[model samples]
Target: MTASSWLLVAFPALGALILLLAGKRAKAWGHLLGCATVTLAFVYGVILFFAADTKSTVDTKLFSWIPVSALQVDFGLRIDALSLTFVLLITGVGMLIHFYSIGYMENDEGRYRFFAYLNLFVASMLVLVLGNSFVTLYLGWEGVGLASYLLIGWYQGRNSAATAAKKAFLMNRVGDVGLALAIFIMFKYSGSTGYAQVFDAVAAGKFPPAAITAMAILLLLGACGKSGQFPLQAWLPDAMEGPTPVSALIHAATMVTAGVYLVARSREIFNATEDGRLIVTLVGTVTLLLGCVVGCAYDDIKKVLAYSTVSQIGYMMLAVGLGPVAYALGIMHLVAHGFFKAGLFLGAGSVMHGMNDEVDMRKFGGLRRKMPITYVTFGLGYLALIGIPPLSGFFTKDAIIEAALGQGGWRGWVMGGAALLGAGLTAFYMTRLMVMTFHGKERWKDLKSEDGRDFHPHESKPIMWVPMAILAVGSIGAGAFFALGHRFTEWLAPSVGETVEAHHLPVEAWVISVAAVVISLLGVLIAWLVFRRDVPVERPERVSFVTKAARKDLYGNALNEAVVARPGTWLARALVYVDNRGVDGAVNGLAAALGGGSGRLRRLQTGFVRSYALSMLGGTFLLLVALLLVRFS
Candidate 1:
């Protein structure tokens, strides 16, 4: 029965292969088949999740993927707490998103292809999590990257979608390089890429601190790229160019957090290196703020939600970065965040469906009544996201905050303050989104679509709202279920390592928790009060500097262009110039000199017998003169 776990990936991969090869011939039923693949995977994942316990780990080899001298990489699936958790999340949320897309993309001509791509995305993520070696993981990692590029650019005719897809692919490539290099480092140092072997080697102190830190940082780079952390995060918001269900599937529940999974899974490397752990903490702290500030300035509902995903993922990263102390917390937040964020994205999709696909929240007002189902489900997700009590966010996020403050010094203060600040900003932006989108004055009296059809926003169909409703329930109940007795964290202990309570807390846990709640409520209150009605749908030219900067993603794009992109471009040009002028110049110059000398020397090949005789006479006369001079001397 456990061996049947291979079916988890096979089902979806086969679905993708069939739909892709069938092309237009299978359009009508392919979408249904695609949905079935993931549904079956989810069912299998559930079975595995329950059957497996803390110590239950099964590594089943399918075939020998790479078997070289002293280097063996197997195409193996690891069934354990860590991989199984991701499998369930990927497949379960995936199945719901697939079902929802049936309605979301019903009118699109390429709906079958879209489902096929989505299935492949899930299959690839499962491969990534279940992989037994770094090589196997890289295989799945690249697969997910390819599948996502396809999904993000599903609207082949749209230039924005095409550009977004390219951006996603290029940015992710940067991370893939990091992952590849890290694997190389592991093989160089440990002589094996298998997780158990690498972990054992490291535990036996086979590697130096520098090597550990280098590998950790390299892996961090990969995480940053996939998870949309700083420096490599600019592409995520633009990912909204894809369909809403894609946003829900890839951004929220699955692909974006592959980095988190990588870090969490590679916990031993990070734990052994102090600077590496702190670096992870710093990246998470900074990116969370970047995400929050950016989220507040976006009027595009999808972009706002996109930034929200960025910020939430930061919380997870921060938790994992807390080293062994909060690995479970990170996983907990990740699971809870998955529920609420997916619901939020799907709910946003519902809003788009009702409002003729208009994304600007300023154009959406009094929609709470018009789209009651969306409002209710989205509202629950909203509360959960903002960390309201009894919701998933509160349970999972508060644990992270409390853990941060528990670090017991200025370190705790700095990281905790950053987390708290991000939380407040999150609430503010999300409340602004809710108010402007659902509770403000009617702003759609003259709204029109691209086709010039008048917009009369209405509720989404049952197919769409049903999934949103289910996810909403998860967002509501997941926190309590997971956090009540520390059940989820305890369950995750065998994999992430047991989290001993942080006894070195700088402040009382209750005090920190209270501040978090108050700060969140404060943000929510101010946003609702400030933006209860009449938002400017059109871009304002005279906004303040913060708004301006944030609207441009806090000049993150410009900064990257100046610091990374521009410098990199100039360096590439310089390298090309040097290669052509310095290296190639020498070779070409030598070749030219040889050619010129040969051309002049070739003139001496005058083939006439008279020329030959004249040369011989000159040589004979010079020889006699030299002979006479030598004799006289």
Candidate 2:
């Protein structure tokens, strides 16, 4: 079993390599190969999960990866509950997405290449979760970044896709720097970057509290960047410029969750630093609100869902920020989110497929009759996302809300209130999405698409809806299955440790749950009352200040430009000026002076013998006069 661990990553990686190398030869079967590889990985992971005693850590040492002095790193796999949980999510959902993409991208000429990139992404994500050391994780971290850049920019002809890919890549690099620096610090202080070594050192109080706090904060910075949290979140919504399947894969299953995984995996570091934990909590709270508020204003189906992903991930970050008491809960939300969010995205894809590839929800209404499978599946996912009872989100999300309120005091009230408010807003926007797209009168009846095509709504083929149906089922039941009898927390205890539930709550647990349900209902009611009447195909020319702000993503991009981008650009230009004028001018001036002095000296070097003879005679006479005067003195 230890030796076989490598197969987890090997399968998809092999598939990707073959797809790329075989080129046109593999085009006929490329999508099949991609789906088969992920399916095989899922099968292996399930077998491994049931076959092994998950209560303990399983480290499979392949070889010495880095054998530097005092820094011995092993190329190994970490097989345990946490890693396996992500493995299942990635491969299982990845397989479905791969299958869905077959139908989604069937007519596209580069479908084979697209599948190869997907396979590579899956393999990179596996490496990220399964690696035993930070360096190995970084290797996969970079690989995921590269694969996402490729996949997001898959349509090279579109400037928006290309620009969005670069934006996502650059923003993530800001966070990756934090992660890289934290690893360097870990190596410097702990003398090792492997999980066990650094963790053991931390447990022994080898690192100072300040150092620990720094590490935790740095890691959080990276998490925020990858997860689309505050100040680093501007890239995610724009990333919808990619294909719908790419959006589903990145937002739901793999990339966005990487931040949560990083935090949960490093629970020990966070547990040691109250300041770090508090800052993380604050960032999460702010981000959730940002995502929710902005989500309410978007007409583009994919961007709305993208912001929803941001908001949901913010919930997970908040849960984990509460420390051990909610680490498993955060992860639970992540898993639940993977199901419902993926379904939502795929459903959006279905809507687009039938509606002339149009993304504007304003152009859609009463689509449920045209695409019943999509409507049913999407509705289930919507219910699950908004915390409707007995759905996955009700089980997972309410737990997080309960955990927040349980923290107690002003901190509890503030965070818990913020979370509840976010919940309400989440319901509002999602309901708005549903009401505008599926509940109201058909808005596209007399309208033509931006591409001047007729609207002919139809159901997607089984190849696409089958995956949505599966994900919808998961969206409905996965939360309950993971939450029942404390099973998820217990299963995760071996890796993340047991979370001691906060006992001194400001309010009863049932109160939080009831309040959450009421707020969600209220949000839904308000959206129905407002949007169920008529949503204009064109945005209103005039709106309130708040509405305008929300539409602008709360000025997040502008803030980034003002605070980071424009200043950085100016600084770069300033640096170039200084290099040219200050540094180069001095060197050039010195060269000019030497050249002029050489020119004067060259004049004395006359080619004529007469000038040489005269110069020699004058030199001899001056020497003789100086010698005579010295003798007289």
Candidate 3:
């Protein structure tokens, strides 16, 4: 909370540097070091959490980073309730994942290297949340991106992993463009990217509505990229190609949450315009539906979870985008999601570990008896995820739904219905996942490991299951605790700004809450009936149009290729042609003409004295003839 709070990031960053630099020498001790750094960070984060006041914000200038003629960007940290909340989530979840990784990745030769990347990511994310200026935030933003690329492609031996990494990097680049432009816009109008200065300027009515709206849209584009919203969202599910721990920490818990944090952090600019919030709501609605449908088609355990993550982020976006009453609701969901999602992912990893590192849920069955701890933890997480009453998801997700419906008129009906439907689909897909993975006939009995040995499914060790258990506890309690007296919303107000009061919903609060529970249970019951006892090992070729489309990522890739990627390719080719034919041709043609002329002119410079004398006599005769003609004329 004081000057020393900088060490929260410094510790992990230094740990990563030393481990990477020491190479083989540090390999044996590197995992321990990595865990220690994050643990220390979490400790400091907790300390700062208690020390930080809900009513105040502090800005600490570390040093002058950029001092130019028209701009000054200082490297400083912003310590406030909102940033602290994110910091705690990042470091706390990061620590648990790091510990879990020690057990899961123990045998890999690159275990130390994995730890290094993990530590680096923690440090980068910390900086991103704590930064006081846009430039500083961007520095951390890019750092997180680079680390994600490295982690997601951890299995470099596989072409798919490499491709997935590139996809993530490139798609994020598409989003990063929006974030960069937003920053430029802020700087252009306000002459500063410092949070306090720009926000103050905005509050003072300095910028016009159009300009503020533009900034909001651009920032939302950036959010869509990082948070895995529509159009820019195809990358996040693909990010599962990395280690499961990476999925738990980066994709599920920390890094993907960056977009929500960004929007919440810059709420002032967004508050200036209604269009900005509406756009956010639209993107969230579409993405949640997209993720929900896609999730139903994936048999890969991790891919299902990946798509689920996409869906959940959509909910968060929808909540925040609703504006005012929903900002706190969005963050509340985000924090609760951090717990259950991490637990679910780690539980998935445990499932994989037991079945010889397999990811196909169709090949798994009756794992409940074998992995008790994992089953219990995953079950709690599942309940939380389904938004069952009293669990985290219920309290947080219900608030968003109620708020959306509270909008009234057609917008409320449309947005609220989308959220409500997404909830049912969420339950349906997740329940389907649970049934296929845990309750069905033992499909693994007939399968063999990649090494051709009989599969013997078993539970992970204490180190792994312990963290999941803790997270499961969080999954159960976090939402209820935050929902109590709206404690979390009040805590975050000083930093995230106040919510405007909105009209109540047409339905009663109890009715809305009851409807959510009923819808979720219906989905679960249907899935139980459909998938509890039977599953197909081979995927069906002929199915419904919805199935086919969902299996193809709802044709998002095709759309991108048709709409964005192909057009981009054509534009690039056109630019290349211009460079070659127009620009280069002009220079090349002039050079060729000069060369040819010089070659022809060289023939006239013969160096013979006799030839020169003859030429001189011929010249003298010609001169006399000219003089005589001139005289006569």
C-alpha lDDT values of all predictions: 0.89, 0.92, 0.90
Candidate 2 wrongly placed segments (more than 4 Å): 618-633
How many pairs of residues collide in each model? 0, 0, 0
**Alpha carbon lDDT of residue 160, candidate 3?**
93
The global Cα lDDT (0 to 1) of model 2 is: 0.92
* Cα-based lDDT at residue 215, candidate 2: 97
What tens digits encode model 2's per-residue C-alpha lDDT throughout 1-633? Answer: 756989999999999999999998887999999999999999999988888778899888898988988878899899999999999999999999999999999999988989999999999999999998888888888888999999989999999999999999999999999999999889888999999998998999999999999999999989988899998999999989888999999988889999999999998899999999999999999999999999998999999999999899999999999998899999999999999999999999999999999999999999999999999999999999999988899888888888888888877888889999998999999999999999788989989988898899999999999999999999877966965758888999999989788667877788888999999999999999999997888988699999899999999999999998999999999999998898998899899999999999999987999999999999999999999999999
- Model 3 spans with C-alpha error above 4 angstroms: 499-502, 613-633
Per-candidate TM-score against the hidden true structure: 0.96, 0.97, 0.97
Alpha-carbon shift of residue 519 in model 1 (angstroms): 1.4
How would you order the candidates by TM-score, starting with the best?
Answer: 2, 3, 1
> Which has the greatest lDDT?
2
Question: What are the per-model C-alpha RMSD values against the true structure?
Answer: 1.8, 1.8, 1.9
